[model samples]
Target: MSSSSLTVQGLAKRYGEFVALAPTSLDVPAGEFLTLLGPSGSGKTTLLSLIAGLASPDEGAVRIGGADVTYRPPYERDLGMVFQNYALFPHMTIEDNIAFPLKMRKVGTAEAKARAAEALEMVRLPHVAKRFPRELSGGQQQRIALARCLVYRPSIILMDEPLGALDKKLREQMQLEIKRIHRELATTIIYVTHDQEEAMTMSDRICLMNAGQIEQLGAPGDLYFRPRTVFVADFLGESNLLPARVTAATGDTLDITLAGDAGTAQAIASGAVLAAGAQVTVMVRPQNVVVRSAVEGSGKLKGKLADVMVTGSLTKLYLDALAPGLPQLVAAYPTRSLSDEHRIGDLLELDWQAADAVAIADAKGH
Candidate 1:
């Protein structure tokens, strides 16, 4: 029943000649919901498996409550895991399925059943305790699986895309459920998913991994607003990266001239120090850009409107700068603001406040 913090020092893995995970160290305070986020083959799951003892690491140590657990077996590590697959027992009733972990440890039938009912109630599915897995909906089955994991009250829970099998609506619904349960239980949870939105919606902090290393790790807004690298900015969300040269550098601003454009732009550059004449990448989110006419004292980027894309509450304006090797830029506007008057081929001016953009050192080989 002890809810303990989890830690890792130099945890890494490899297969043959390739390194799947380089040496990495992280700490998850007790009761924190930490998410491992990355694209496929980015070592997020490999790190999770290492923490779960599902795979051995080439070099590293895992600690729980400040005690060494690197070499411990999964079951003995006091961790419960919920996989993308429901992994529920088809032949057993939901109650038995939830009670399996307790039963394995020689718990009495009465105690296991009581705890199983409690776990079901915790997941808001007490009524489905006696139903078979095949008889429940996918969401309900996943909830049951969650309940099964909680029955043992492990110190930490490792969830690997538990909602990956659900449709969008169901996945979103379950995200709220998982968030509510974490709030209620306050247990340390380490979740692994390729879905960035899910990580943003549910995690207290996000650890974004890539190429066997941590790309950028912080609160969702921190990573999105002030990315330290171009890769981090582009990966977190939609970005309109423009090449620029640092014409002048100050303590708070980096004045740069955009490639293929004559106007100079200023952006926040305190995060990464750059000297004058150094090349930088202007990191601007599509939503932060504004389409308008030429305005004094504003950095104007002129482009022709290429197309419009409407998704839910936002309208995206794709603009072509006609620059060689550069892709079309995008600016997102509120759906309500996009009227019939807007059309393609219109010469429009795009501008963004210097505070809204970050200047990252030009990443090579991107």
Candidate 2:
């Protein structure tokens, strides 16, 4: 199947007084899997609707493979869409359901049958070709829906919460299956979901939206490790956001004094320019935090161990920061690395490497 590049230039949408999407521009290379991810009302679905031609944009252009498709209808966009409900005909056989799109396109009977079978094989559900949709499990039905979409070989595929209805295990299984098919076909896909983990697992790049606008756009690691805004940091994953005042800039690192008497620490600024007196938030991932009875030097955050949880391979420690006005901090470690020393009510020292922490300006705090 041939893939096509997608470009949205200055796309904007509004519902009377409320803005559904701000002026947004993005370039998706052919075969790149990009996810529109965010919380509800963050414009992810709105963006997907506009791209699929289900809704018209108030302003902007949509181009597929460099061709202007702003005014084109959904049918002419050459895109396939998969929904959470697995929109398959209940009465039709799985093979006939997969071939339905080809029938509409007036493909030859033998060719459609062969392509339908091939699509079923791609999704690893060829054995159920003769079964009705009701006879298959939820996961198998979803695979059949995907096969139906692929039988016609649309240039782009848009999936909106395709696995939202499945259980955790089944959802994970479907994620891998869809990724496998994507890898095999190299088709351009624009997926929309509120699940950060799902986006991280499946997307080549993620476009995070918030408050009807794009908050960040980058690889999962880039958004997780080096977020440009506090919302991105807090929304993407668990983070320890410490309020601090910048004390000085030391090369690429910045010396910051934590709020209250939490002492001072150095953090990599990651190119954020700030003055000495600038208020900022230092973000540290829980996995990067080191918990020990004693940290060698000063600048350690002392806290009482509020709780400890051992979950299979990982042990989580919750600590109440000794500093006034500071929120509780959480630290995660490998279960094998911890002994019986961690207990509730015990005072522990928390520390992390300067490189593992990021100092972000607090002006845009959420």
Candidate 3:
């Protein structure tokens, strides 16, 4: 259960002329949880398949625990895999299904049964071992599928959206369960999912892919707080992008004039390079922008509240800039912060700290 380090160099895959994955390179540390996150047709699954030995890479090499496994077949690779569909055998009892992998490896019946029982218990499904897949609920069946993969005690586990079939509450519960299992087993896990929140909550690091290429790879907080590319900023979470021109540059901080309705807002350069007079995009999170009734100080722009959408925990206020050329903006405030005096169409000043604002090159395209 200890061997979990994986490394890929220039991995590429193709189906005829259409490339499934480009030259992708990534390193996953042992006993760490790494998630491949992207939208559909973004090569997340293809990368997982390449790692699992289900599909061959046309270029590059795959190494597990410092050993080359690029050309190895799935069986020879000795990795456990859980698919989105669960892939349980309906005809077999849960116990037997969990024992199948051990049987394939030629383990004795008594030993296989003991291991199967332990695996079932690991996933909290010991009582359902005698039941058939058809008799179990979707979540229970998925647990069985997990048990089957765990019985062999493979060092590396590849899960392809394993909880995608479950309902929202069940999916959240399973996310915690899987994270706990990863911590307890200390196995190297490569998970694939299109859900950003799921990846952010469970993974130690996330590899975001786009159009057969790796867009960015980093810790969830790093990706969220300091994105390198425009696509990463837009895809990972909600952002209010305002056009700006750099007025001054002092080291990492920059004084910029915001374009459109909101007259001018100061921002700091979050990226590696920035020069004075450069056109940039000011990246501001909704939570970072503050809404106030009175203009307390400078760097505040007046805006009219266009709409307010109240969710249980927070309220989202859409504002139209009072200035002629400024763009409309959205701000999210905690429910507790709302006062009885505020109403729709009221004028409010929107302001944000320079440090909270991220400035990126304007030429970077999506």
Candidate 4:
């Protein structure tokens, strides 16, 4: 299948006083698997709808392969959309459902049948072509829906939570299947999902949306490891957002004092300029934190261990008040490495390397 690049220049939408989508600009390279990820009502679906021409934008434009299509209807945009509820024809055989698109385009009967067969093969469901939609399971039906979309060979394919209706196991199974198909066909895909793990597993890049605007756009690792905003850090994964004050700035590193006497920690400045007394939040992942028996020095954060829970592969340790006024903190270790000597109410010290922490500006808390 052929693919083309997609670009959205200042695209936006609205409903009365509620801004469904803020003026947003995004460029998706050709053959890129891009996922629009966010919580509900974060403009991910709105953005996808605008790109698919399902909704007209209040301003800006949508371009496919550099061609203007902002005002075009959904069908004229050369895009295929797969929805959550596998929209298949119950009365039609699976082959006919896959071939229906080609029929509408007036392809010859022979060619439509050939393409339908080939599409079913692509989705690994060649044996089920003769079966009706009702005879197939949900996962099987969703595969048929995907086959129908692929048979058309549209320039771009948009998936709006196509796996939302599937069970967790089936959804995960389909995620891998979709990634394989994407690799095989090299089709440019713009997928929308509210599932964080789904976005992380499937996309070449993730465009994280919040409050009708794009919060962060980057590879999953970048967004997870070095987020530019607190919201990005908090939304993408579990993060320890410790309020702190910048004590000093030295090149790309910042020495900060944690609030509530939780001790000082050095963190990457991330190119942001801050003075000696600027308020910021230090973001640290739980896996990065190392907990040990409390020591005599004030170099590490001191807390009382509150709980220890094991979650198969990892053991999570919860601490109460790094100091008298700090919020709770959490640290995780491999379940196999957890020490049995540590007990609840034990005094503990938490520390992490400076490189594992990042200090972000205290803005955009909403």
Candidate 5:
């Protein structure tokens, strides 16, 4: 199968005065897996609906393969959509459900049967073709939904939290299966999810949205390692946001002093614009912060260990606030590397490489 490209220009949707989406624009290249990620009420679903022709955009245009499809209906758009619920007809056999789309398009019985069989084989559910939806497990039912979508060979696929109902193990298993299908078919997929780990694991790029705006768009690593805004940093993963006063700025690097810790650290400025004496936020990932015993060369901050939480592979250590009116600093260390003798109330030092932190324009809260 060949891949299809999609583009949206200034897409906007509204229900009277309640704007569901606002002036959103995106260009999805052929054969790419793009995920629209956000919290609830962030317009991700509205954007997906607009693109799939389920909802009309009040402004801007939607194009598929360079042809205008802004006013096309869902069926006419030739795109497959998988919703959170499996949406399979409980009364129909799996084979019939898979062939329903082909039937709607007036495909011959023989050809439709052949295509439905192929779709079931593609999803590794050929054995369940004769079973009803109620007779199958949730994972199997979801596979049937996927087969139904593939039977018609749609140009693009839009998924709306398709695995949200499954348990953790099943969700992870489906993530790999969907990724494999995308690779084998070279299909352009636009996926929507509120799960950060799912988005990071499945997509070639992530479009992070907040309050009807695209906060940041980049590869998973880029969004995690080099967040351009405070919201992106906090939303993407766990980060230690330290308030700092910029003492000096040179090119793309800034020398800043931590407000409460009374320590200096150099961080790469996210954008081109930077001025001296500006209050910036220093974003340090929890894993990057090293918790170590006092050593001759390591930078040390005198703080008592406030709490420790051990989960599977890592131990999260919370340190007492070093500065007045500051939140407790947190650091995560691999469980294997942690010393067994350490306990709460033990004084420890935290240090990290200057280059590991990111400097961004200060915002109210994360």
Candidate 6:
């Protein structure tokens, strides 16, 4: 299938007095895989619906491959959309389900059947053509749904949580299948999901939404490692956010005093140009938080172990900060890294480098 570039300019939506999506603009290069990621009611699906012409926007326009399709109908937009549920015909065979799209556009029967087989082969499921939807597993049914979408040869495909209904293993397996299909077809794809790990695995870029607005948009690693905001930091992964008073702002570093009796911390500034004595938040990922004991170097933070939970390969340690009223924080290490000396009730110090920690505007909570 030929790929297409997608552009959304000033796109927005509203339901009576409530704003469903704020004005947003984005550009997706041809053949790129972009994911819209957020929690429920975050407008990711609403934006996808608007782009697919399922719902009309209150403002703004959408263009596919340089053609303005904002006012066009869903079918005229030439885009294929897959939903959470595999919407397949129960009575029809899998081959017919895949060919239905081609038949809708009035392709000849023989050619439609041939294209359906090709689509199935693209998904690595060429043998299930004659089986009914009930005869196949959930993952197989989802693959048939995708084959149905691919049979139409649309330049753009929009998927809204296509694998959300499957079990964990199946979902992960489908994620890899989707990525492979993208590689082979090279079509412009816009995917919507609330799963952060799924987005990270399949997307070329992630547009993280929040409260009808785009919070942060970037590659997966950039968004995770260098979050632009506190919400971006806490929402994408586990984080320990500490309120700190900025004592010195020099060059690329911001020296800050931790809240309560916690000592100083240094973190990289995020272009906000924090002023002296300004209040900011320190964001350190759990893996980045170093737990040190009496044999430590530059730890300064003193806390008692409140709990330890071991699951699989990782062990999580929750600390009750002895640094006055500072918030309780957590650190994680590989289970094999934990020693007998690191027990509950043991005093520990938290340490991390300025380069590893992030500084963002203060927020009360996620």
Give one digit per residue, the lDDT tens place, for model 5 in 41-90.
89999999999998888999999999899999988887999988998888
Q: Report the C-alpha lDDT of model 2 over 1-366, residue by residue, as the tens digit.
A: 999999999999999999999999999999999999999999999999999999999999999999999989999999999999898998899999999999999999999999999998899877998999999999999999899999899999999999999999999999999999999999999999989899999999999999989988999999999988889989998999999888888676888888996878888775467778878889999999988885645677889998888887878899999889788999988888545678799888988899999988876632
Runs with alpha carbons beyond 4 Å of true place in candidate 2: 294-297, 337-339, 364-366
Off by over 4 Å in 3: 294-299, 323-327, 337-341, 364-366
Q: Using Cα atoms with residue i matched to residue i, what is each candidate's TM-score against the true structure?
A: 0.95, 0.97, 0.94, 0.96, 0.95, 0.96
Location of the lowest summed lDDT over 10 successive residues in candidate 2: 291-300
State the lDDT of candidate 4 residue by residue for 217-240, as single tens digits.
999998888888888888987778
Better of 3 and 6 by TM-score: 6
Candidate achieving higher TM-score, 1 or 2:
2
- Which residue segments of model 1 deviate by more than 4 Å? 294-299, 322-325, 364-366
Best by TM-score: 2
C-alpha lDDT values of all predictions: 0.87, 0.91, 0.86, 0.90, 0.87, 0.89
Cα error, residue 308 of model 3, in Å, equals 1.0
lDDT of 1 at 21: 96
Give me candidate 2's TM-score against the actual structure: 0.97
Q: Write the per-residue lDDT of candidate 1 for residues 1-366, one digit (tens) a residue.
A: 457899899988889878899999999999999999998889999999999999998998999988899999998899999999999889999999999999999999999999999999999999987789999999999999999999999999999999999999999999999999999889999999988789889999999999988988898888888888877788888998888888888876888888876357789873667878878888888999978854554556777788988887888889887445456889997788535456889877777889998888876622
Cα RMSD for candidates in order: 2.0, 1.7, 2.1, 1.7, 2.2, 2.1
For candidate 3, write residues 1-366 as lDDT tens digits: 665689999999999999899999999999889999999999999999999998889999999988899999988776899988988888999999999999999999999999999998899989988889999998888888998999998989999999999999889988998999998999999999999999999999999999999988999988887777778888898888777788888888888877753556777776667887788888888999888895645556778888888887877888887657656788887877544456888889878888888888876531
Error of 4 at 184 (Å): 1.0
Error of 1 at 272 (Å): 2.1
